[model samples]
Target: MEDQRIVNNEDYAVVLIDGVCHLCQGLTQFIIRRDPAGAFRFASLQSEIGQELLRQGGFDGESTETMILIENGKYYTRSTGALRIARRLRFPWSLSYALILIPPVLRNLVYRWVAKNRYRWFGRSNECMVPTPEIRRRFLS
Candidate 1:
């Protein structure tokens, strides 16, 4: 609820993630490293702002297992969101967007399986990730 006005603008895309999941945190870091232009911003699914964004995008705010990308007023979820994000990344990493050509039903099957096991295989933090001083500005409070 920290003033949702900022999210309405199309200045950048927003990535909503399971902040406590180690894999999700790593993916955020991965995007940051590859995106020097800072075209993406982030929010933890449990945060007030995140839930608001989720609700605005017509998704279930309570579901944290799925990754969501909000761009230009449209929202992409699950594997589609992940691939769309990859499409904006640098070079070879951006090439991963090609996977989007596969059917969503097939792609999401793998995504769902990994999401189900992520907490067990990668472990999660008791609290959401705290962005570093250098990257803190990129996170929505």
Candidate 2:
């Protein structure tokens, strides 16, 4: 599958994250910090751009159950998406890709646990966050 991986230079990567989830917000920020070159762009799963991408990618646009990564056109979700994001990030975090060896079912179990309780643990925003001006360029309005 790696052989089929398309470099995302021409097509900016878009990450669809749950808008109100604090954990999702933090993860987006983490990716932004680790990706200074701006290799990735972000959208709230509820946003128009995000919904359009989800529909185009053959996903149920309203489902906020998992993080989605759209790269070059193809989309990845769940644990696969997280691992792929990690692969594009800087060192230490990039090391997370090694977890992909554990099998997706197992990896996703942990991811789902966190996502299921994210609101309880991390709280949530009443609306999608407004990006600070410095990072506004990375968000797909």
Candidate 3:
């Protein structure tokens, strides 16, 4: 059997996303495309790892509405998490980190608005999309 790897708070960034949301899955695909260096790892909010992390971070899984980025033991939610992930991405994609300059309040307002309607606007998936064999290692199922 493959050994289970325990995530170290400092070495990896854990992305918490909705396992059944189409928009969330698309965003995960987008990140995978841009993160060619294997800089990020993903976990569905419905997964075991995702649940553990959310509990550790004091997040209520039932009401989670934003993606979470956990880095170096700290957690960033909403736009902050999105921007942090962008910052770690490769070249042109990393440019999106610049959005950090916008005030948090403003950024979060936009993020929350989109999050609120994401299900209605983008729909939900019956299950998380399966990653290709090549990139499967990056996902924490």
Instruction: Indicate which candidate wins on TM-score.
Output: 1
lDDT of 3 by residue, 56-99 (tens): 77888774599988776678999999999999988887899999
Quote the lDDT for 105 in model 1.
100
**Model 3: lowest-lDDT 10 consecutive positions:** 1-10
Candidate 2's TM-score reads 0.90
User: What clash count does candidate 3 reach?
Assistant: 0
Q: Give the alpha carbon lDDT tens digit for every residue of 1-141 in model 2.
A: 221232243446788899989999999999999998888988888997777767767788677989998887678889999999999898988999999899899999998998889999999999998889999999877
Candidate closer to the true structure by TM-score (higher is better), 2 or 3: 2
| Candidate 1 residue spans exceeding 4 A from truth | 1-4
User: Model 2 — which ten-residue stretch has the worst lDDT?
Assistant: 1-10
Give the TM-scores of the predictions, in the order they appear: 0.94, 0.90, 0.89
Q: How far is candidate 2 from the true structure (C-alpha RMSD, Å)?
A: 4.6
* Candidate 1 global lDDT: 0.90
Instruction: Give stretches of model 2 more than 4 Å off.
Output: 1-11
Query: What is the lDDT ranking, best to worst?
Result: 1, 2, 3
Evaluated against the true structure, the overall lDDT of model 3 is: 0.84
Itemize residue pairs with steric clashes in candidate 3.
none
lDDT of 3 at 26: 93
Whole-model lDDT values for every prediction: 0.90, 0.84, 0.84
